[model samples]
Target chain A: MSELELQNKKVAALASTETIDGEIATLNLGPTHPATHGIFQNILQVDGERILSAEQTVGYIHRAFEKLAERRPYNQITPITDRLNYCSSPINNMGWHMTVEKLIGAEMPKRVDYMRVIVMELARIADHLVCNSVIGVDTGALTGFTYMFQEREKIYDIYEEICGARLTTNVGRIGGFDRDFNKEFITKLRAFLKEFPKKFDEFGALLERNRIFMDRTIGAGPITAERALSYSFAGPNLRAAGVDYDVRVMKPYSSYQDFDFTIPVGNDGDTYDRFMVRQQEIRESLKIITQALENMPEGDYHADIPSFYLPPKEEVYSSMEALIYHFKIVMGETPIPAGEVYHSVEGGNGELGYYLVSDGGRTPYRLHFRRPCFIYYQAYPEMITGSLLSDAILTMSSMNVIAGELDA
Target chain B: MSEFANTIKDSLLEKFTKTSYELDGYGEHNFFMSQDEIHPAIEFLKNNGFIYLTDITGSHYPEKEGAEFQVVYHIHNLSENLRIRLKVDLSEKDVHVPSMTDLFAGANWMERETFDFFGIIFEGHPNLTRILNVDDMDYHPMKKEYALEDETRTDKDDTFFGR
Candidate 1:
């Protein structure tokens, strides 16, 4: 056959399997796909470039966090919480601590609450930056990712000064912080607060209104407000769908009610809308941290609950009561009250809730993490149903489904 | 319970007379209902401003006779800024509860996760297979009977560790 005829034959063969209507091909998006950024497996049925349906297989990294939490003493469980949504692990740690405090009815000091607000806001900024920057990376924009990552490093440095750890920071204790912010922490935070805005605004200007970014994300994987709610979407994802339901504003845990920050809501609930919502939320988080720091309360760093908080080393060495309490706590013998409490915090991704059922034991009888990633990720297949495979990847990044959080 | 929770309780009690309401730990609203009343009560709540389904999870209570499993649903009313926890106790003999996927699409995975962990079956779940665990695994890992540490491990014996 002639060369033209051979080309025609090849086109016909391709059309038979790929180009023709209703001809579907299965694509495995990952148990390990680079663009996914996490260990999520989506068995996508594609009609050419358009996705017909997506069946996701999660739990590839399921560590059985709830089961493990049931066995560990309340304090030991903080480390486990660190792994969930590790991008904003401080929020998880604090949320767990607050849940325990609520069960025990330990009233935290105003200073502790303010300190928590600052740390939680910093963690939120870190989480949103990771998510939004990943969205940019998915859309072939690498400069913004690099820039924001440097800023995230500064936040991590602050975390290091506070807790002596960076990522997966087990930052706080049951009633409040393990220790008050040191001079170094405050100085670093102040520096971060001063320098962060200029760099952040530069990053924002790079993609917020850029024609390429907008075109790539504007209507990709859009979901209506009603559908978004039905899917139990939370955080920036839900806000992108035009819902103004922020857990911070709605519930006001950790003295969030005292801060003055606006909740940004978007209209489209698409990749672009999700991106913008997170962008504006970082600004709101900055506002919250500044406010919390400006109005820093004067009091103890942690609550006066001796049974929960570890006594000072000097006291533990000199005082019998301190020695006994410290030994009891270290041995996982702290007397936790029997109660059922569901406490939620505005986590980096969404409303991170802890449903703790204590049976008056040292450890929780049952602990359920109301992981926002796991709940909202169920909507992914629906969101990207008719969109291109590229859009599917973008949508996944925009949803900010951390595999740890999703599988926890 | 707060005033808003009381309002919800009154409305819920008015509709579902078989349900019981109380303030849970931290004074949050909690409703205890039979398996039959869950779907209708939740539907009513959905119609009455509790549209957001926050989470669905199950806790295993092997010691509790006749009610070995408890399924919990946390729903939020965004307009009122109130949250209510609804629970249904399932007997070991019949570990099935009606799925709320019809009401909240988010409940699909939550119910699946519940089933995966506690073996609490959601009767109407479109896909009720194990979500976070291997499909061939014989037992749910979250049940109290399953020890947190693996029994099959031999190297980390308590005697060897001087316990």
Candidate 2:
């Protein structure tokens, strides 16, 4: 046969053969879809309803936070961390500041430690509520979401009362809180503690025993404990797989050792396990917050290091030393020592670790954030391999895959 | 101390000279091996119970002349409850290393991320496309020389001859 005839025959055979067996279909889940709570897109190769392969395409909401932090001063990085995990901004803020503090060897007072624990626990509760509520919403239950969101609003109210901001709360400073928690903030937190349990019980009862919810969650996206640990899954997801590792209980940063709480664990290692683990964690967080509030100390909130933290307004006006310190800190002229430190905090989702390298300049030499969601999201393709598309949504929601943290 | 990390380290030291392996700052059983020994070291680690690869990351240090890229691999042993970190330094000119995804399937995205951020090339990575950035982007933003241009800047029309 001639070369041209051979080429024509080969093209005909290639066109006749199927590229993918049993028909491969592509589905775009969303950069703006309801399934993805935030801006995230997932491209799925579906064989019928089951996902043959899934690829999570993030960076739609990417603000290049790490690059931005490298350019900004050490103190200015807190607000960027605040946006990394918007639902738990205080956790991110405290985690980032604590990493910088560790690099500088900043010693914080006991009162400041207690305050940090309290705020962090509050952020934990707020973060878990959103995760659980969204899981319920994804499973086709809306009432529980509304109830949990109302409780989340109460936590936000406490945050607003403590700091001027609600969501992006730059409430924490380098060595301690930006300011002391006032009587109103304490009173409202006490009220939240008293009222949250009843509402929590309602949320739990609403979803825990519901037959359809249980069917959708149990055994859906079940990852083995070995696989979970291999993926570096931490916080509730790791605990959900029956790994009794909690950064707070294990590492105990920022006086987390002073508070008493249990690390909840789940054995099934499925979407239901993750959901149950987070639900119980909300209760444990409440206990920790209550203890922190009861043992709240009376002393300086911010550290005495006026060069790093802003001095009080009274001190700024009255003392020339404080005024100079204020001017230097505000203008980002403070010299941070050269060193590196890795500080990991047990964020609501998992281990939110910050590894900061400083060249003794005002800005960080390099800042690497080990975001929990990013680690968890890495296992998404495997997690949803044989599950339905709806199971993928449940898995994402159960994993508490925050786009802010994942994309960052 | 876990026997798994020690066993792997001893085995790696046997194949490569002691000068080629240096302990990390933590004094944990972690070590930074020379880049040439990475594939064999990973193979040894996998064959001897370090089955789980936890995380892979790339750190860029521009000051170092040729040794600018530091690739980190975190591995865990389920039976031993131990974690070990293995690091290898790669240069900007040739940032190629053997892919570990064949041993640990979870290393797929982690290696892709290192390649995406540090421009490191994994010899056997299955689908080695840009995982985080657009395919058209020319530079790796995580590198030291990457400039931060203002995204909002636009060119004006004042260059027209009529104006």
Candidate 3:
């Protein structure tokens, strides 16, 4: 084929798949470039400044979590989940814990639930801070970026107080927490509750009203409710399109029913609407944290299921029964019923679901993680089409497609 | 089970004759369908208000007779706040099922991922190729028949880890 004919054939295939009209310039964005946040590539067919079509290439960081989960024991798989959307790993840890608890029929007490709620809300705030501030940085405003980083550090300090690790926190256990929250931890969390919202509002003031930021985001990458629903958009992305569907409200798990908070919704699913929806969601998370702290119940932090929760370390060293229980858990010898369960929580980005199938084994017969970022990123190519190249970056930042979650 | 979920279960049992079990009594339904019956079953559920497709995944069973591969669909009805799981079994020789991309655009990547990991083909899918795995990978990694450890590694002995 001649060169012109080859270009025509390329356009022909692109037109049939992505549907772009007339001739266009092709621009390849990166596999290792900073624009994607995580590692993914976008090949865009552009007509000058306007993007006619975009083709996304993902899986740069695929670790085969499904294949790997088949070999490891149930507890060993917790660390694997921490890598998916590492920005908010507590939700992943707690979501996995609840799925296993459901399988083993372990019921936790109200105190355990409240403590979990507190940790989960803190993770949600950390996730939104990264998203909103990154959106600000994309708009050429750096002040909010640095300001929000400090608040995120406070969240890390809280995580360090609870668990040793911060970013990829493998914190919770199958039935409950490894230990109860100490007085020191509760005090630190209350301090965070008092201090974070003010910094959050100050950061919002920098971008929510700035003229240049508003013009760049108001109409960029707008997705209709019909298309958004058809595409299975969830969390803030779906909420930004005027749909009030939230997993926490529609399907409450982990004692979320006891908490009262409003779901934030937006009129247009544009860049501006997505940012605003997350901003309001941060406020709602603050309200939930305060309520969970005030009405905190008193009981064991973990369920009394010995097979699910490890015995105390001191008892393990002193008592034979405790040592045997510790050995059973460490060696993955606990019994599990043969059944299937699907449990989901309102993750930082959207609905984080774990579909686990157990065949009376210590490990899972089959485990599937229904990551929201993986599902929501499908609409990216469609959303970015007909927008400018720079606006495509803004749309991606708003979507917050962590490469870790995308490739998993 | 919730009232609406049980209602869905009764309706589905009447039509498909598949047994409905209350999984953990958690307001969800589980049932199985033949490969040939899945397209119409999905269409029936969609018409009945299961507007959102939550996920499309595959599970491999190496020893089951006439059901070597299981293609599972997690569908949700946002209006009623209901979720249902429909599983279809296909033999190793014939691992093909009709695609739901026509119904849900979100199934595009999920179907591709299922195809990449489990080697199940979607007959009418517009594009079906390796998604999470490198395009050059020759075999489906999720199949139990495949070795868990990398075959290329030579330094470690298999007996030490009890592989």
Candidate 4:
């Protein structure tokens, strides 16, 4: 080749490099991608096939939930929380209701608390099934994802039997559940308890030992305990880093302290650790559910607060006092004393907290949700910094970021 | 009665003499630090075992005569298994506070969210863009002054999801 031609080619290459330098190539991953579980968008800055930085642009499904809760009555807020993390609606429902109940200083019966535990644990199992299966699917294992989805469908069917709605279930009331779990619902749940453990074992065997699956997740998105904690990561994400801090154990709400279970911790804070922690958690949750059902006390499902909880249908039609109470509760006449309460539940993803401020009115003054995904999403760029683009997707699935919770 | 709350309170109060910090009975510890002491206060918290920076949320209290906004920082310690609240007061005009993103990477989006909702800008945030709200949206929805009714009607036309 001529020397002049060689010089020209070198100059051309330098110009192209300069154009791309310090300008992180922006790539819109989704608002509609299978990898992103929900409608989440990540404006990725890529260098070749490696992701240099990722700016998670959520709010595609932002429901203005906090703002909506402020306008609605305390009981009306349950439906709103249902949409926050739709996959784990029961946990969100219980968390929000518990916060309100705490603010009001309302006490529930032992039976009610046990029921809450059963429902919440069931929700946790369902949530983990989705998270683990999605991680497997992202890592090129689709069969396990489908199998888990079928299992999750059974759980959803149970939810429908208890509450009219499945995904956005406004299940629990302020003090306790809206109604008692009938014989059929209990029967189905008992049968699920019998079947879930075996299926769970099958799920673990399928993906936990797979050579291809292990390669994709073993050391992928490794985060130190210090880094995980520093990033305000919670739930399984923090536990996967070997932190034995489960809110259910540390600060038990809804009679979680009554149950005997172990908090699973992973030594290496990687995708594999996260996946394993979640799988183990499913087992623990199943145990909790079984224990709750076995030890459940028999009593009224809801507290005897006529103003806060709805009166019986028979009483509503029969008496003027019941009618007035019903009207007052529906129109949000029952006073909510001026106070603020911050309640945190160990949600499927991590610590799902609801910080509610009440001005003694029917509606909430300000409701700030401390969403786990929002916190974990911050460590995304750090987790996927030097890894391949595929690893980034896997890391996100393991993170279990629900766009609803993040945006809310 | 937990050692975690007491340890955090003692450590923070000892570190910053002027800052008023208190411990709630339900395991939540609160530290009321000045804007100037926020960086140093957070630095101390990070080093002294408060490793997790869970969330940084802003609240506007226009009714409280002089105080316009209050910013709350929720931090957790993994080893001790404790959660604490660190707060600072900011006026509407000069709503600047030292960014904790340098210490805790998790504070990045949270600080942006505070900025988006209550318009309390983090001075050194790497990307201080609107998170929940759309870009070019002027009003801070969380602020008391921003009318929710006006936005609710307009938001219907702009976005289909009502997020």
Best by DockQ: 3
Clashes of 4: 2
- After superposing candidate 1 on the true structure, give the runs of residues whose Cα lies further than 4 Å from its correct spot: A1-22, B1-4, B150-163
Give per-residue CA lDDT, model 1, range A1-408, as digits (tens): 632254346545544555547677889889999888999999987778977667889889998888877767889999999999999999999999988888999898999999999999999999999999999899999999999999999999999998999998998888788788999999999999999999999999999999999999999999999989998988899999999988888888888888888999999899999999999999999998999999998999988989889999999999999999999887777777788999898898888989989988778899999899998998898788767899999999999999999998
User: What TM-score does the predicted chain A of each candidate obtain versus native chain A?
Assistant: 0.94, 0.93, 0.94, 0.92
State in Å the error of residue A227, model 1.
0.4
Better of 1 and 3 by DockQ: 3
TM-score of every model? Answer: 0.94, 0.87, 0.93, 0.90
lDDT for each candidate structure: 0.88, 0.79, 0.85, 0.82
Scanning candidate 2 chain A in windows of ten residues, the lowest lDDT window is A11-20
Give the residue spans of candidate 4 off by over 4 A.
A1-26, B2-18, B21-29, B151-163
- Model 2, residue B131: distance off in Å is 2.0
Clashing pairs in 4: A62-B163, A336-A360
Better of 1 and 2 by DockQ: 1
Off by over 4 Å in 2: A1-24, B1-30, B39-55, B73-86, B103-105, B150-163
Candidate 2 local lDDT, B13-39, one digit each (tens): 787763145453334355677777787
lDDT tens string, model 2, A207-304? 88889889889999888887786677888998999988787976688898888789899997899999999988998988988898888788899787
> Which tens-of-lDDT digit does each residue in A209-270 have in candidate 4?
88988987998998998778777789999999988877888778988889999999998899
For each candidate, the DockQ is: 0.57, 0.21, 0.60, 0.44
User: How high is the lDDT of residue A343 in model 4?
Assistant: 88
